[model samples]
Target: MPLYENRINALNTIEIDQNLLKEVQVGNQSVAKTLVDKIIENKATKIAIEGWYGVDFKKIFNLIKEEAEKHNLTVTGKSSAGLYKSSEEIAQYSAKYLTDDPSFGWVNSDGHLRDLLNPKALQELRDLKSESDLLVVYGPGVAVEELSDLYDLVIYADYTMQPMLWQMWDGELIPFGSDEPDKNYFWKQYYYNDFYLLYRQKQYAYTKTDFYIDAVVPEELKLMSFKAYEAMIDEMVKYPIKQVKIMQPGPWGAYRYRDLWDIKGLECNAWNELAGIELSILIDIGLEKPINILTQNIMQRPLELVGEYVHKTFPELFPLQVWLDDGYFPEPVPWERSSMPIHNHPSTQYVQRHFNEPLGRYETYYIVESYKGSSTWMGYKEDADLEEWERLCRDSDNLKVIPNWEDFIKRWDTNVGDLFLIPPGTTHGHGGNQMILEMDTGPSIAGTEYSFFTYDFARNTWDDNTKTMTAKQMKMHLEHSFDNQKWIREGRVRSHHRPRPITQAGDGKYRYDQYETIDEMPFHIERIFMEEEAPGDTQGKFMQIVTLTEGERVTIVSKRDPRLRTTIDRLQACVIPASFGEHTYYNESGRHAMVVILRLKKG
Candidate 1:
């Protein structure tokens, strides 16, 4: 039986007040009827329904058109694509940022929705208002500044990430101004250009829109007033927040997740606890079902959520990521099948120069559970042959030879609660037979691809579609790996990366020990053990991401306001916002609770 429940009611939820919840309308018919009533009551002439990239604007437009026809009103609708520039022009402009790299692209920083618009088309769209009694401007970018005055009432339709990704995969997601999806640069353009522009548009829409609609399920649309949306967000920031966990199966996956989580069918490898952008937040507002929104929505109040210093340091981004690397198996398996590919993340300077990213990837692994023969591989042995290792990696990439990775890599025995700091350029792999809690500095949108894979021991990967092992060689970026690789020997790896923890502060009921971290590490890890409870304070400086490593359950509550509290389960993680000051951890399980706290080091 799985020890952890896949779904926890308290996690990733914001309870909306009853008064505000009463205004939320469920189902597409209810939402469409309400909008039609509003138009009739206010005698609104022009209405704009702006949506996220993957929204079904045709369905929404038809619904409203049907409602208007019943009232004997002449309704005419035009997609916002009419106001967009030609597909060729948009592609040419996006080419600068989406340089020929298939796996990487530069962040389109200065690009806006207006850049993709045509002045002639904008004027044509403006002229449509006089032709019909109800002029409906629909689709993405309809709420942009250029068209802000064109609409009497603006509705912002939002979609969740999972459905959006599925739509893109199904080849149904056509970019604005394009009749068909870009077969070659479909994903690249969406991430770098389309998603970025739409996200910025949504941020602006949050302020000016009259209503917000959850269009994740096209048939079951949820409509709420803009005031209700703002009120829900205001209440959300006052407490700790967690994200829905995302489980991914990989070739090097182990058996621990099969037993720990209630996941079926797929072998779980990585459990994303609080990964930015990749996860969704579930908001509860006394509805039949919770509303799912992008995890990035929490950044709406950056200062209150992450603090001023962090907000300024990593503008418009979450600065940390938390995940579980499951490597536990009941019995020992072959090293090639269980071990991760020998890879290294890029340095801050290297990424900034090459990828135009904000920060580098710095990772740490804290052993949550370890079985017999559990180990972690990091750095190179003192007697390692650099030239031979490089040659083997290159040959392996071509599927010509298999490298004996053990000869060059250094392995360290992992124990529970042991912290291993993995800075950039350090070649590392999570050895099987242990469950590792991986906490790392969050990567920017484009920075997520900075993990330059060096070698994979010439192993085949598991093909989910075929349900069999396939002979697929992993892609190796040897040149980048060689340039960024640090020549840390076994002695240096043990002395510098692994350090003893010293007692920072303690009392009769609790104890706090601070782990020694190197200067290269921007974050600090501390262990808090509580017999009954332990008090903590963020000092309004930085956000604290915590994992309840031990104990059945623990409640994190604000000392000033007890009502503001969230309960964390064993092996589950949550973020204590910077604004959530003077909090305490109460051990609800009556056991000695152990909590691991990760935060940016004070400047």
Candidate 2:
């Protein structure tokens, strides 16, 4: 029931407190009378309400008509070729007629799409631009801010498109090509239509558009170098192959049509390395011309440089591979070779590019101690970052999250002893052993261009003894680019001495806790534990929060406080928030009671 609906007693729905709206105006500038306020409005001569998330057709026409009428004119609703269903797609003869006019088109990823918008249909509307008419696009997540300057208007609401569309138009019908600035409004919209094959088949089956770099993910939960892969292959048996259309949507299927349900055999000899498993599948619609990204946290790609990259990788794939470049990706001011970028510019916003709904990513990674002989001052970062993974996984069903094979992999890697990438949302150094040799890049962990790395480390060279960035070296380099004040104040290097206590729930079995994180970032740190027989206090316990799967190890086998402790080894993480104490874990058996400690704060 709507909160407003429960006026009889306590309300649990949205009751528009007329006064509250005034307060909201001051409190949250981003929100207005409606949800989305259009940040940019360019008057296009011609266009179509082809589609976008949460939009309505009648509402679209009404808005356009109202805007047009304001100019003593009314919108002449012309049906573009694919305005409803492309005439070409429906009636073979009609297909040529509708498609002949390039102004209108559809978003199915089959091969027929010409440009982001069909060109022919647009030409017809060009005349209106000169007359000062406005073309209002009806779509969801179609934020003009996130894409390569596409629509003049956007309706950006997560769920309902109708109310938002009306509010932006203000009970008026706006026509295409209206250059009226004060009257126009909307939030930057975002659309994942380009990334899904499932959306392609039912509607615009033959229209294939070019895939862009906006879809590439910059960070992995944990890093897997050639060595880690080799170790994993040796330990795990070759899993059998099976072809099954998944019960749910998967990463591979989200991008292309034929890829919709083609998950086939998992080959041990995956890709170029025997270290990973390569599954067999085919693209459902467009066979994307593959490209790599030196992308940053924001998915920003310099427009010119993006072209250069595509030219390099897909020489044969050529200009046809396609891409959109947003100038948002941030790079080190003075490029640093000695260390990784303090704050990576790779774009999580690029997740918007995946026509694949529910697929967004936030990534952060760091170091842990190495487990070498006789406490030889060596140990690898633990692979089971239980606190971090749990949180990210908990919201798995919400965002178009990729499948959690990584979660299981992290656990398995833990038991067998291998380091995995830290889950995308954690700034972790397993519990309290702060070692040298840690590098990470993630989404907006902070609101500004600040990335915090500890410059204090014992070692400054790689295993081969080549000079590498010590905690000090990395810090010195970052000082040139970052505003260190915040780095010092908000995102200072983390350690046990400054351990931020994050509370979580425990049923004497599952334990976890909130880790610290910064604003503009969406991840929290957490700890987890399980133990069958507690280690003696004298020897000290082994607490690690690595990302590998602890195969066959139940919550009972691994135990710890699931809170931030510099002492224990083997911690697991889920993306739980701190302050609320939402991250906790535990294990049974007093003799082997396990404690898993972790930390979390919004990042």
Candidate 3:
């Protein structure tokens, strides 16, 4: 039998003020009508529709042009693409940041939106602004600093990440300066160069845009004034906010998600619960359905959302990631095919030197639910053969022979509420038959794909293209893995990584205990066992991630403001901002509750 039914609730929505909701206009026609009215009222001739990379600027421009033509006015416009650098120039300039490997690249720091624009074409466009009733500029980077004075009214077009990825997968997106989509190099270039360039552009546009448009759905565009957009973000940070969860299947995916979530057609491997760079948040604005906004946008109020130290440290970057690893299966499965690939992450100095990222990937796995044979793999065995293990891994990759991983790696029997700290250089993977809450440091704004895969136990994965299972031989970074490997043996793993919990505070009703972590780890883990209620505080320093591992339901409320609160069900998590200083947890169900809390260490 499965551990739970299909009770997974992935919606993360917050209700906002209705007055602001009324200001939100739906559909391109309505938004275009509003913009046309604004142009007439202000007697504006120059208009700019600046957009993020994936926005449909052509659709918006056409709608506005139609609306302007209705007023018996002449409208002339051009896409920002005309001002972009040549394709060869862009590829040459981006070569240093991108890597030979298709999956990885360094975050760009050397180029800006203006750097990508041809000065000659820019001057031509500026000079071409005519005496028509409306002179319009549309596309990404149209509102950049160089073109700031080119428009009298600026509207910023935005979309969420999921739809953008879908467009990328469908080959609908063409990279800047390139006429056609290069499937081979699109992901790396977009993540490393395009994302950062547009991110910086959006920051500047935020200050100057008179209106913001949610173009996630092209046919049904949502438009609001800059004031309303700012008000929405301000209201979001006032309380706990949850990011919309995204689930993915893997070669070693388990069947638990099939039972837990209302999803079909794929086995679930992991849930990206709080992956700030990858996921978005749903905002309830008294609409038929909640509007989706990128999770990183909430960081506009960095100090309020993440606190003083984190705001100073990360600076517009959401520094944490949370994932739920599904490992439950009703029937027995082969250990090789059921386990995760043996992998290790880079250290801070190592990542800085190699990838030009800000922080290293530090991770922890809190076992939320476990069955009879649940296990976790961490480090190496005390008596393992290192040289033979390396040879076998290479043979598995090159010769199609599965290596005896148990001979080299150590395994521990995991139980619910057990916390395992995995610092960089410490090899780790999740064994089957359990559910794990993986909390880790988000290393970059581009997205965290830093796990250096070593061995995959020679499994077969489903291929969407072929409609059949195919041999899954994942690329391995053995050289980097060996360089970062600490070779933590069984003794050190038991003594250092899995320290026994010490009671920090307790009363007759509730008990709070702190789990001792390794000195190198940057975050702290604690659990609260409550019979009815428990008190907590963020102290105005660090943000807190609260997950109900063993509770039916619990309500987290702010003591200062009783109106500010959210209820989380079993296995559901919510982020408590650092500004939510003092809060209390009330167990909604008349049963014992266990909540795991994670926070970054104070410097």
Candidate 4:
């Protein structure tokens, strides 16, 4: 029997304070009103408000002052006087000290404002202290150690970090275009490192601020007190959640899948990556302003979210990351397109020794869509020549060298129902002209693509202008590829990599197709085909990552709470929390539906 089978309220073990949690709301009008009420209660004669860019502290302060005056209290508002400058200003500094990229003005990777606050600004803050009854210092610089002595209470109002494809610039969601100001600035700062810096800053802020609130929900600023906010995380961990999709351009990207999902105006190359699975979840607490937070952050409390047993086994992170890799080939190809870069991830020992990763990547591709001549590259010929392959890998470092891959690499003619397991150290790539739903272990913490690229078919990535920037990836690829090679014959490969159907529940309503995702990897994947509908229970054992691979729409209804149901469309994914005990999936579209489910191995 599952350990949690009788522990229905496993989450209730963690204590939380509702009143304290409500103090620090996410950014909302209530924040201003709350401050006003506080000032009135204290009967303070003076008050000052301070914060960072994007937030009009001056305007918000004025509104708070207006409310305070009704109670005959005098209030003053001043924006933080510190290293508050625009990206353009930071660009000028970068040009002087960092990169020569003309577009370097858009880089925010270096959090320099903390170190560059002017002396005059500090004096102005000191001056405000003598004139106000209450000083509310808030903004990006408020948490800086240098400005520690300037405020009575520091409320950090921040938005969720915008995805790389889009950013909140001056209150507008702007695409990272190849223009002067918006130029592909990310490449200049170095893609993964910049993201790491942002992650570090976010993690660091919790220690710096007296309180914090998520200001992401537009027009609905809910200030959740830091204690309450952190405590409220229990609510998020125990609920079924969906990750907002993040789409980016890839050389093999096609618009058919993107259009099908109503994701417009993207360079639809690839949907997600094996490593870069930094996903966000919308915290729907039956509130008007739902909070959006990173799944990594929630899973940091794995015991609360995934259960104590799973947490002890895999601490601080969710083990799985599933995404779609869509590729298209027009009838008459304009440019030569080949399969995904022939590559393989590092072994568990190799990843731990080299990259300090908790687990090595292991992925399974379930084919959802296939076109003419669609295939996948897996394994290698029994007699493949490594001496010749090394010569080609070295020679093609700077030149276009095409080799007869079929003579050396094994191939599999794929169809819509095919499933392929891609274990670490296995050479595999999705052949063009097919859309594959890839379910894999989460990426390394460093967010670096662990799959070492062996051959690119002499092709370039979708972003040609950033070729100079991407050239850096090749050096890492060359270093990791040589020593991890594993070649296999047809018979050996067939025994391990082939897909097969598993026994389904005898309800006669659904069938299950399972795959052994790499030998001894502690996880397995199966696809459930709902002819009409199907009912099953987690048995309080494990969490399941369910993706609606093929169906117009399907509703997952909780037998415990029918009102707490969610509908997922085709090609979308959602997590079924382990505590969501008994549930039933209904084919709301009145047709056959396919749901690919991924779960950890039972003890």
Better of 1 and 2 by TM-score: 1
lDDT of 3: 0.79
Instruction: Report RMSD (Å) for each prediction in the order shown.
Output: 2.8, 24.0, 3.1, 8.4
lDDT (Cα, 0-100) at 550 in candidate 3: 77
Each model's lDDT comes to 0.79, 0.23, 0.79, 0.58
Candidate 2, which segments miss by more than 4 Å at Cα?
1-203, 206-343, 346-362, 366-491, 494-503, 507-510, 532-603
Q: Please count the clashing residue pairs in each candidate, in the order shown.
A: 0, 186, 0, 22
2 or 4: which has the higher TM-score? 4
Residue runs of model 4 more than 4 Å from their true location after superposition:
1-31, 39-131, 134-136, 139-154, 164-212, 217-222, 225-232, 272-277, 284-289, 332-338, 445-448, 464-476, 488-491
Candidate 4 lDDT over residue span 1-603, tens digit each: 000011111111222455664565434457667866765665544332322223444445555667667766555554443434445654454443334423221223344445435556656666654454555554444445555554445555554333332343222332111112343344434332333343444455555444444544445556655666676676555555666665556655564554564434454456543212455556544444556555656764565456666677655546677777877656634223546777887676776665445677777888888877777888877787867776777688624755565676777888987888777778878876788888777645433346777776666556434422132222327556667666555556688787676765545678766755555455778778887787756556677888887878888877977755667777777777677778888888888998888777761
Give candidate 1 regions above 4 Å deviation: 1-17, 179-185, 445-447
Q: Where is model 1 poorest over a 10-residue stretch in terms of lDDT?
A: 1-10
TM-score quality measure for candidate 1 = 0.94
Q: For candidate 2, lDDT tens digit of each residue in 1-603?
A: 000000011111112224322222111111211122221133333333333222234444454465456455434444322222242333342232223312221223232222233344444334334333444443321222223244433222111222223344453322222222224322211111221221222123112111111111111111112132222222111111011011111111111212211223311100010000011111111112211111111111112211233224322111100000011112222111212212212223332232111112333332222221101011112453544533443343222232442232211111111222332222322211111112122211111112233221222222112222222222222221122112121122222112343545545543444444545433333334444322211012111222212222222121233322211112222111111111222222243333322211211
The TM-score of candidate 3 is: 0.94
Give lDDT tens digits, candidate 3, residues 1-603.
011112145444566667877778887788999989889998988889987767888889889999999999899887887879987898888887787755577778657888889999888877884878898888887788887887889999988777777667767775676535556547677778888898888888888999999888888888888888898888778788766666666667777766555654444454435434667777766666566688778888888878888777766667777778888878888777668888988877877887788888999998888987898899899889887877787666633645467888898998987888899988889987888999888888766568987787766665544534474566678777777788777788888887667889999799998888888988988889999999998898778888888769999889998877888887777778889889999999999998888889972
Local accuracy of candidate 1 as per-residue lDDT tens digits, 1-603? 011214454355567778888778888888889899989988999999987867788888889999889899889887787788887898898887778865667777767888899988887777653668998888888888877888789998888666676667667786788545544546777766777788788877766799888888888888898888888878888888776666666677677766655665554464445445456677777787667667677788888888998788778877878888888777778777778888888777887787677788888999999999888999899899988888888777735546467889998998998899999999998888888888888767422546778887766666656645573866678778888888677888889998667888898789998889999998988889999999888888778888899898898999988888888888888888888989999999988999988888952
